[model samples]
Target: MISSLKRFLIGRPLKSTELGEQRLNKKKALAILSSDALSSVAYGPEQILIVLATVGAAAFWYSLPIALGVLILLIALILSYRQIIFAYPHGGGAYMVSKNNLGITPGLISGGSLLVDYILTVAVSVSAGTDAITSAFPALHAHNVMIAVFFVLFITLLNLRGLTESATILAYPVYLFVVALFILIGVGGYTILTGQVSPELHTPMGTTVTGLSLFLLLRAFASGSSALTGVEAISNAIPNFKEPAPNNAAKTLIAMGSLLGILFSGIILLAYFYGIAPSEEVTVVSQIAEGVFGRNYVYYFIQGTTALILILAANTGYSAFPLLAVNLAKDKFIPRMFTIRGDRLGYSNGIIILGFLSILLIIAFKGRTEQLIPLYAVGVFIPFTLSQTGMMVKWFRERPKGWLPKLLINSTGALISFSVTLIFFLTKFNQVWPVLIFIPIMITLFKKIRKHYDEIAEQLRISTCEEATPIQGNIIIIPIAGITRVVENSLNYAKSLSPQQIIAVHISFDKEEQKKLEEKWGQWQTGVRLVSLHSLHRSIIQPLTKFIDSIERRTTGSNYQVTVLIPEFIPKKGWHHILHNQSSFLIRTVLLHRKNVVVATVPYHLKK
Candidate 1:
């Protein structure tokens, strides 16, 4: 029933051969991959306002310059990552680039940073999307966290359904958002040209708090850099594109960067002309929409599409994070399960884990975009800087054609990205300190996992075994609670292995029970030896494990393995298993650490 329900929701599981068809075309790729960077315009200008607002109304004039600065940096990063795409086209994300060029430690650090950043991306995007709704409806403000969590879960389910399915479904909202933003820009530009600003927005322009300073300008620039967080995702997910994958991915990057530049600068200008100020009550985009559309249906349409696009923007993180995790797993940094494809051929483990982490951030921050924004760009910028640095190093080593110019470009980008990383640290260290703590923990974990794998490999290394080597003898020890059908089946299966001897060991907590079982075994004449033991403390696993240890110590034969056969009964229904204590589980848990001891479970399914 569970499998049928899962099939119903995500469709039938695709075979491994069906994975090749999951590639996305350019148009659908843009809709799925670029949403995070593109939808960021909804709040990018407002973040600048948040920083500059500290210096009062005069600082508002500098908003355009700060945004332009961010744009210049954006183009530089796009060019740098374009090189990244051409050079390491098999999805040259920070993890791969840094690990390849810099080393494993640097790679894992960048990977950890990106992992944290993507989680924050979902949190911030969902919170910002909820902020849009609350700005319009007002009454929904109290339910922001709940709404953001629901959106995260919704995106997770959509992703698990399959990649192409989610991308196709999300394409419309992205298109709608782009169309809505352009309409706002066009109508707002018309309003400016006509010199007919709304009365509600065009108020007295006076100094209220303080004077503008260079510090405020830099802060605004740093905050506005959030717009570039998801820009590198295109390069990271190059494999997901259709044939001519690298070319398609590069084109998509340029397309996204162009849209981001135009809309971001255009929105800031509209807000400037309309005199939209950053307010605690509503978003700057909300204010601009109202100024242009005048509380009409277009205003609500803009609001609804803005919310939709922002929520769906989490899809960008969902697309890239899992793929990055798969890369990390291949390097043995994270769990191997992340590399395993789900029934739908999607990285469902990473997707579900990302959803849960994003929801935790939602609950922690109460779905406040402002609070989450401080923690946002820090993660991405760390990777951005490292990826560029890795490329810069790569160019000098490989000295590919046009190395000098490409080298200079990546170096410049690295400098700029490094500057932003430092700025994020200085400006919002309190908010972003968690990332600082997280990276080292992940690095330590990676080393430990590597150590364990290395040790296990060494231990399991096989000696030279010629074809003349004879089969080794083995002994089977069966632990049974009674003379039931489950025991009969277990002994019969043990006979198939052709063990030299089969011994049935029963642990009795009561003396009377032990004697009764021994009498019954004698009467049955089962041929298998019945070894009865008394447990004074009523401990089943402890006494049984000791008996196995005594046998291992007494065994004199070489090239022989000691095996313990555990008999288990499977109930007719899933819930019925819970009615019985899981003795087999306890036995294996203790015996797994012992050397040369194998515990095998033999099951007899019960009919109701």
Candidate 2:
């Protein structure tokens, strides 16, 4: 059943020869790494408005402060993660950062938080994308779940085909989204600025003006910070960059930060100028698009294209999650399966697991981006908090000569990040704190389970001397067939056990081969005794059992323990079972039911 499920999930495994070498250049690497952050422009504004909806139109202005706050936090985090990439250009991101600076426990916390965040990233991005697309084509709104499932499967297949294939395909859509959005915002802003009569778009039908309070502002800020989700993905993916990994990663980080800042800021400004009101029902971005382009063909085209970009934003998690899992496995925080590369030299297991979990989340939340938004930021913030704290520790521990400047910078970044993390937790507690609490609990349990497994493994290990411990007995039974290499090797290995006496025992069914075997045994040395039992009825287990009983009865006065050394062969070809068979298995099963008998296998390697 497990094998069938595995086959179902990953499909057929490709051969190593079929995969070829991974040849991602710097440009391609940056594209693949930046896709998630770039895609955020689609939903970031929408999320900000969703937060402000609870407090009505007056609180909509608060989005500016909240967005600016998020921007400040983004800058600090980008700078801090830049230092991280410099320190760990080989990848591992939060896991490596916390593990190196704070210890394994903190590293595991970072790993768990990053894992949850990545999965959420995929689900939230894809769902929000689907919502955007549905907004343009109201007819398909009912089948949002189906569309989400299809995209998830499609992306999963693309990733499985290998990174380069997926990156090439995804790069164009990401570029189109960026260009279309910038064009719309630029044209819309110009039209509004030049005193051209633009459509006075009203708020969505159901929205009303409700008064705001302190708590509402905090929630709005927390929600707006979701735009900051994919900012750290590049830091985790630095190892995948071309040679001079640090420089390439730093450049990618700067580009991502600059692009995200402009795109995010432009969307917010455009939404505000166009009078895109807060809606508990409809996205402010969609409303802004409708107002700018109306319900005409061009507007629908922009909406559809924007939705596609948002959906592909989930691809960021696809690129980041596996790398995080690989790093966690390296730190022994996660299972070693995550570290095993597939034929394409990507972490296939981790990727598939991420895909499956993201699907579950998409289904659980019923594809509602607003509902999942709160849960989304919690995990991201936890890692952000720990990573910043870890960076502060790193800055102090390895203080360079001109250290005060660097320390102040890192400390300030750490302070901002950690403070936002605290606010997000406090404000989002009712909605998101459960996940924050749950993730750490899981991390602790996983660590305990791993420690327990390690202890059991240590206890079960066999030492060399145990293999050579002498068996005290008057009679030593060495089960043999003909004088084949398997039988000879078993005899030699059994001798290493240093039994008090040695006897070569055989059960013969055919008279002709029995006579030939007896003649061969006649040439053996004096120290060894030969014993043969007649099994004319052709039953191997019965004869062996009777002979062991006879030997035990005769040696009642001495310490008698029968040691059976069985020669076993393992096949080279997985499908060669019909050609060769093993008899030691049957013998071992029968001997296990007997008293004062022990069985050991002496493995024989077969020629290819």
Candidate 3:
């Protein structure tokens, strides 16, 4: 029944041969894998306005320029990764690329960074998704953390249902979100082009800081680059695409990049022209929608779709992180458990771990999108820089037909991403440091795991000393407390194991009890040797432990096996065991530690 329920929830387990059925085409892949980049438009422009707002409304003039700069970086990343798709078609994300070209240490670092980035993608996306709803209805503000966590769990369960199923489930939201935004831009654009622009769009005031400095502009650009976080995912999970994987992945990458660029630039300019600023009660996009459509049905539609798409965007991490974990496990940098697919052929361990880590982040950050925003951009950029840097090295070494352009393009991406990473560290040091520190610790853990696996592999290899030899015979010792049916059953089973020698032993605290057991054994004529040991301490486990230890000493270098048969009666009801003491458990625990000892339990259930 339990297995049936699992099947019902996650679908029937797939055969390893069915992996091809799970491979997605470009359209579904775009919706499944590109949701992260697509959903970032909901917050990327707002992040710019948020940082710019620190300098007050006057400094908001730089929002367009900062967003445009991020747009350029996004394009460079897409172009660079397109070359990556063809060069390393077998799903070479930053970790694999860096490992192939740079070295093991850089590869480990890139893996750690990308893992953190994927976790943060889930956390940040879900939190921002919850924020979209809260912005639409302030009454739900208090439940934001709960809402965000629920979204993560829901997406996790969806992915566990299998890739194609989840892609189908979540694909509609991406289209709805895109359609809603286009409608918003169209209606809002009409407002601006016509004389119907709200007069407030042209007015400005509220200068918190006196001057607009390069530091503040750089800070704004750093924040806006959050949009670039999900670009590498397509590269990371390129293998999930159908045949002609490289071209499909490249086309999808270009399309996602182009769409995000359009949406981000359009939204930034719209928000800029519409006089929308970061609000404690509403999102920047929410404000823009309302400012254009007023408090009407279209406004609610935009808000609802935004919330759905933002929440579903976390599906991007679900779809990609598992594949990354599987690859890492194959490299032996993590536990082998991740290599096994679940009922739906998803990497259940990785998806579940990502969900839990994201839950912690949501709870720790109180589910506020702005609170998590500062820490969100750095983890992703590390991989971006490393991936491009490695790709440039690949171009130079491989010297493919178009190596020069690809190398220059990747070099440009590497420099910009590295610069952004540095600038972000300076701007958001307090938040960035935790991730930076955590990354090295993760790399160290990976190295330790790899080292342990290597040692274990060498040890488990064919060796003469530990080679198997058939068991010559068995000496069974039955710890008989008193003559009972359970003991009778244990002795009968022991005779089958080896009728040559079976000893029924009793640890008695009183001579009277020992004498009674000896007489009873004589009457039963069980053909089992009766051995009695006096226990002044009245402890059952200690004396039994000593007997096993003495046997181990006698058999020092021999293959003679010593089996300790512990007779235990099964109670009619489970709770009846609480009424009866668990001495057999104690005896087995004590005997298990002895050399050449096999502890076995024989149970005779009561007919009650």
Candidate 4:
């Protein structure tokens, strides 16, 4: 069943060389890698305002300080992770970092945290995009769940087709959005500077300027930190880069960081300058555009393009999450299936799981951005904290002479990143603490499962003692349906074992077949005893097991062993064994349960 499902979902597997054919160039790779980071510009500022709404519009200015804090954290994280790409460019990201430095538990934590973050990256990006689309088209505002689900399905299908396919499709719109955004920001800034702003700039939503407090500032900082959610994608995706992975990865990081920083900062500043209100009814970008180019075709075109980019940005998570899970699975922090690559060499199972979970989140939140934001930064921060801590350990362990400048830089990066992580934790905990607790619990469970697998693997290891155990008092029993070459082969193999006694057991599911089998066995001159067992229940394993137990009771003595020879029958095509025959497997499992009994199969090929 599982095999069929896998074949249906991913099709036949491809070889590594075929997989290599799907390798993405740096340009395509960057487009895929930067999707999540670029998507942030669409809604990162809106998230800040959503949080600041409680404190009023005056608190919206807090986005500046918040954006600054996030920027500092982003720069530090990028620099610290550049060293990671240099050190371990094979691309395990947080999992490799934590495993190499902080041990398995920390590795699981980082892995689980990153997994959750990836799922949320998809959910949040899609939800935010859907919300923006709804804002533009009020009809969609009422059907948010349907809209979000459709987008999730679209993204899932695109990714399943392959990363390069999805990247090629998304590249132009994202690039167009970036250019349109720059143009809007440039035009808006010029309009504001020349004091040619629209009348709506002075229309306030009853927001009064109030003195800022530490709590409010921290809240703003936490909200604005959404921009940093996608910064780690480059690290997670380093392996997908072309030859010279570290150089490509470092270059990708720098490009993503610089572009994201400029776009994010520009959007926030433009919104603030144009007196854009933070309201659930209106997005800041739309408001700023309206203020700058009120109801103009160019403004609507840019808005539409921005909405498309936001939707496409979720593609970044679609590209990265599966690869991240594959990395974790390789390190034994996730299930083995996650490590299995598709025809495209992407972690297809992980991608499907991510898509399913993101869809669930989108459904649960009813595609509301406001509802999902609370859970957004929690998972990302956990990995940020652990990754920074791991880097600190990496720095200390590899202490190099005359590398003071590098050491100091890493140390400062660690300090700033760690500090921001703490602030994010404290500020977002009330809303996101549940996810923090949930992630650790999952990591603990994963470790326990890994330990169990290791123990089972140890027990299954082959030893010479097992192969050298001498056969003593061998009694052979052959299970038969009727007279055929399949049965004859089993009888011959039983004789070859040179058993002290040989018995052929026939299960009577049908009286006529049993009578014919009995008559045939009576005529056979193979010198084998015949025993018939009645199975009123019409089950094979239970009746065969009872006969074996009866034989064992008759010969209870030291060094006595029972060898059961089972005839193999092909029901139809050869692969039909999987589709139709399960009784043979069940009998083998039941027989193996006894210490003295060993089951063997004699195969009879069916003519094609």
Candidate 2 lDDT trough over 10 residues, lowest sum = 199-208
TM-score of 1: 0.95
Put the candidates in TM-score order, highest first. Answer: 1, 3, 4, 2
Error of model 1, residue 391, in angstroms = 1.8
Candidates in order, TM-scores: namely 0.95, 0.75, 0.91, 0.83
Q: Is candidate 2 or candidate 3 better by lDDT?
A: 3
Q: Which tens-of-lDDT digit does each residue in 1-608 have in candidate 1? A: 99889988888889999887898999999998999999889888988988877866556767777888898899899999888888878894888889999998999888888888788888889888998999999998888888898999899999999999998899999999999999999999998888787645543444333666666667788899988889989887988888899999989999998999999999998987787889987888889999888899999999999999899989999999999888878877678899889999899999999999999888987787567676778888888999999998999999977899999999999999999888888777778888777788989998898787778878778867734445477778999999999999998898777646788999999988889999999998888898888899989988888888888877755666789989999999999978999988888788888877987889899999
Between the candidate structures 1 and 3, which one is better when assessed by lDDT?
1
Candidate 3 regions exceeding 4 Å error are 198-200, 203-209, 464-471, 478-489, 498-501, 504-522, 530-541, 565-608
**Candidate 4 positional error at 502, Å:** 6.1
Q: What digit string (tens of lDDT, one per residue) describes model 3 on residues 1-608?
A: 67788888788889989988888999999998889998999988888888877767777767766877898899899998888888788885888998999998888878888887788889888888898898888899899988898888888888888888888778898988889998988888887889687756643434345777788788888989988888989988988999989999999999899888888888987887788889878888899998888879999999999998888888888888888888789999999998888877778899899999999988987886566666767888888899899998888898979689888999999999999999898888877888867877998999899999999999779877675976777778889889888988998898887534677779999999899889988999988899899999998877877876776687667667888889999988777889988899888777676656888899899989
Cα error of candidate 1 at position 236, Å: 0.7
Please identify which of the two predictions, 1 or 4, would achieve the higher lDDT against the true structure.
1
Candidate 3 TM-score, C-alpha based: 0.91
* Runs of candidate 1 exceeding 4 Å displacement: 198-210, 463-472, 556-559
- lDDT per residue for candidate 4 within 251-343, as digits (tens), equals 888988888899889888887767677777667888877777887887787778877777777777777788777776665656889887776
- State the lDDT at 43 in candidate 2: 69
Q: What is the lDDT of residue 441 in candidate 1?
A: 90
**Which residue pairs show collisions in model 2?**
none
Model 3's lDDT to the true fold? Answer: 0.85
